[model samples]
Structure formats: structure tokens, C-alpha cells
Target: MSLPDELYNAKFAEYIDSMKIMYLVDDRFKMICDDYCISKVNAEKFRQKIERDFQHQLKHENLSKELEEEILIYIMKNI
Candidate 1:
């Protein structure tokens, strides 16, 4: 399966190949990637609303980072 576009632009893009393999073989990993993609998309929206609602923007930023870390750790363990 093709990954969400956000995955390619993320900081952990370097490990994308591993992520893809995991995504294809592991249902949990695929769910994680889907969640990560949703979190990232929401974070991007929040970033645009930074001036209107800084708190939510900050919250999403932190959540996005956490999800990114989770993906990285998952990939590492499976790789």
C-alpha cells in the first residue's frame, strides 16, 4: 500500500522504506501510520490557526511529535 503523503515529508522520511514494509506486513503498524497521518494533517490545520488558537496548535504539535516518535520506534523494532 502507498503511504500517506505526510510520511514522505516527515523528519523520519529516511526510514520510509522500513515503514512501508512494516505497514504492509503489520496491521498494528498500518493503524499507527493511519493515525500518524491523521494527526499530521490535523497538526497542519492547527498550525494555520496558530494566531487564532495557539493552545490547540501547540497541542497538535506535541501530538504530532509523539506520533512520529512512535512510528520511528515501531520501525526500529521491526527492522
Candidate 2:
């Protein structure tokens, strides 16, 4: 039988942090572009790509639903 290593969680936490930051940046960038009247090619496709990435991160990172909700709330509040 093998036991989980406590220290291993630190790396996973960092990965989650990175994913959260990327999601935040992507969301903010899209809003900023909209405000600036910047037209992107195939913008819906790009949005879908980012959405898929964020969903994958949430699922694979194993972050709690509450935490994910809070992160999104924070982003919405600030931007």
C-alpha cells in the first residue's frame, strides 16, 4: 500500500494558481479588447478555446467548486 505525500500538494496548488491566473488574464484581455474596439479574427473560436482551457484546468487541478466559484466572483468584481 502507498500513502499520499503531503508535500506533493504544494506543486498541485501552484498549478492551480497558474491556471487561475491564466483564466483571469484571458477574461480581462477579452473585456479590454472589447472596450478598445479591437476586432479579433474568429473571436468566438478564441473564446471557446479559453473556456475549454479553463474547464480543463478546473477539472484536472481538482480544485473545489467553492474555490472556483470564489475565484470567478473575484474576477467579476474587479473586471
Candidate 3:
């Protein structure tokens, strides 16, 4: 199933944030984020952009259970 653009963007953003945190402390995490389309500079930019765009309470909900499961498996395999 395809996700709405907004949902996909939000999920990608959340994943980026998690990766940034990990990247700051772990080299492996940095590698994973880079592999997944987020560079160190890009991750920082994403954080700033998210904060600015979502001034109010921003929540990310993964409605696609199958997609989520698939992503988890993919991440696990890659990591």
C-alpha cells in the first residue's frame, strides 16, 4: 500500500531525526543514515526545517503497519 505524501514525509523525517541522534554518538548510526538518504549536513537541515515548519505540536503516526514492519526489517538487515 502506498502512503499519502504527508505521511511518508513525516515518517521519513522521524527516521531522519532518530538517525541524527544516533549518528552524533555512533559511527555505525552515521553510516546507516547516510545509506538511507540523509547526510550529516542534511540531517541538521532537516531538524531545523521540521522545527520551523511544525511550530505547534507535531505528531508522527505510522498508520501503515505493513510498511512499518517492512522498514523495521530493512533497517535491521542493513544495520
Candidate 4:
């Protein structure tokens, strides 16, 4: 699977080494990376909106956080 750029972004970039390892061996890890990227993009879009949708922005932010936690946990366990 192609790694998502979000995985290399500042937020999770430190885990790139571990993530790349898991990403190559586990499909689920790749899915989580994909989800994180999507949620991040959505959150940014909401942030940039002139008429902001705070609810949606918060939702995406929360999802991103949860997914980030999961990724961290997975990396730690598998590393």
C-alpha cells in the first residue's frame, strides 16, 4: 500500500519508521493511516471555511485524535 502523506506530516512523522514497518506487514495499519489522512483533510477544510462548521470540525478533530491514539498504540505494541 502507498503510504499517505499525512503519515509523514508533523503530527505523526516521528513514527514513520515504526509505521512503515507495520504498514508493510498489516493491512489494518494501512487502513488506519488512510482514515487519519481523510479525517485530517476534512478537519483542515472545515478550518479554512469562511462560514465555519464548528460541529463538523470538532467531529473530525476528535476522530483524528482517536485514530492517532490507535496508531500510537499499534506502533508501540508492534515495535
Candidate 5:
């Protein structure tokens, strides 16, 4: 199944915004994009990989749901 460009772009923007906020909070917080040294193309598989990796790290860190959601919302609003 293929995803439309609009959906991909929106999700990519959201992911980038979220990552920027995460970076601001923790300079050590690394993303797959950084690790792979690859450009973001907004592909569905790439999006899923990013989301999965982020969620895994968040879970491992035991970060609070409220804090995560707040950061995400703040990023969405401000960026």
C-alpha cells in the first residue's frame, strides 16, 4: 500500500518538529536519522521505523506520558 504525499509530508514535519524538541530537552537524545546519516524522504517504512525507535527509547527511559505528550504538543504548537 502506498501513502499519499500530503500524509507523508505532514507526518514527516511532525516527526522533525518532535525531534527538535527532544533534542532541545536532551542533547544526548539521538534519532535514527542521526544514526543513519541519511536524508528523510517521508517514506511510510521510514516513518514507521522512526516512530518505533522513538517509542522504544521513550519506553526504555521510563519517560512520563504526560511529559512526552506535553513536549509533543508544545512542538506542534510552536514549530
Candidate 6:
């Protein structure tokens, strides 16, 4: 995902938004966000990123139901 200065700057916001949404739906997301001092005003920018990511991953990953559940657990643990 590396790029030239302007492109990187542009995409950085998207990636941050993605991470913010990842935290948003997560059960522990609020606690983690507060720990990092992220404000709701900024966090709201991530509202759709998680659903987008889920759709993308679901379309591309093609995992079995069990594997999908496991992957979700792994993500929850690491985040």
C-alpha cells in the first residue's frame, strides 16, 4: 500500500477510517478507543468501513463457516 507522498497521504485517511470501524463494532472497541483518546467526532468517520471490509473479505476469502468464526475470534483477540 505504499505510494508517493500525495497518494499515501490520501490513502492514510482511508486506512485509519478502516481501523476505526474495526474497533467500532467490536465489543471492546470503546474501551480501547478511550484508552487511545480517540474522540467520537473522528470515530464517526469510520461508520461504514467495517461493513465494507466484511463484504470485501466475504467475497474474497471464501472461508467455511467454521473458519470464518475462527478468523473473527482471532481478529477480536488481537484487536
**Highest lDDT model number:** 1
User: How would you encode candidate 6's per-residue C-alpha lDDT over 7-58 as one tens digit per residue?
Assistant: 2244356676565565566647545555544444345557667778889898
Residue lDDT tens for model 1, 1-79 = 7877878875877898898888889999899989998998999887778766877788899999999999999999999
- The TM-score that candidate 2 achieves is 0.28
lDDT value, residue 40 of candidate 2: 40
Candidate 5 residues 1-79, lDDT tens each?
2222332354467576566566556546544435333343436578899999999998967767777888999999998
Clashes of each: 0, 0, 0, 0, 0, 0
Candidate 6 Cα misplacement greater than 4 A, ranges: 1-38, 63-79
lDDT of 2 by residue, 1-79 (tens): 1112321245556665454455456767435534433334356568989999999998867767778998999999999
lDDT, candidate 1, at 37: 88
Strongest candidate by TM-score: 1
Instruction: Estimate every model's Cα lDDT from 0 to 1.
Output: 0.87, 0.58, 0.59, 0.84, 0.60, 0.59
Model 5: how far residue 49 lies from native, Å: 0.4
The C-alpha stretches of model 5 lying farther than 4 A from their native spots are: 1-42, 63-79
RMSD of 2: 24.5
Q: Is candidate 1 or candidate 3 better by TM-score?
A: 1
Q: Which ten residues in a row have the lowest lDDT in candidate 5?
A: 1-10
TM-score, every prediction: 0.56, 0.28, 0.28, 0.53, 0.27, 0.25
Ordered from best to worst lDDT, the candidate numbers read: 1, 4, 5, 3, 6, 2
Q: Candidate 6, clashing residue pairs?
A: none
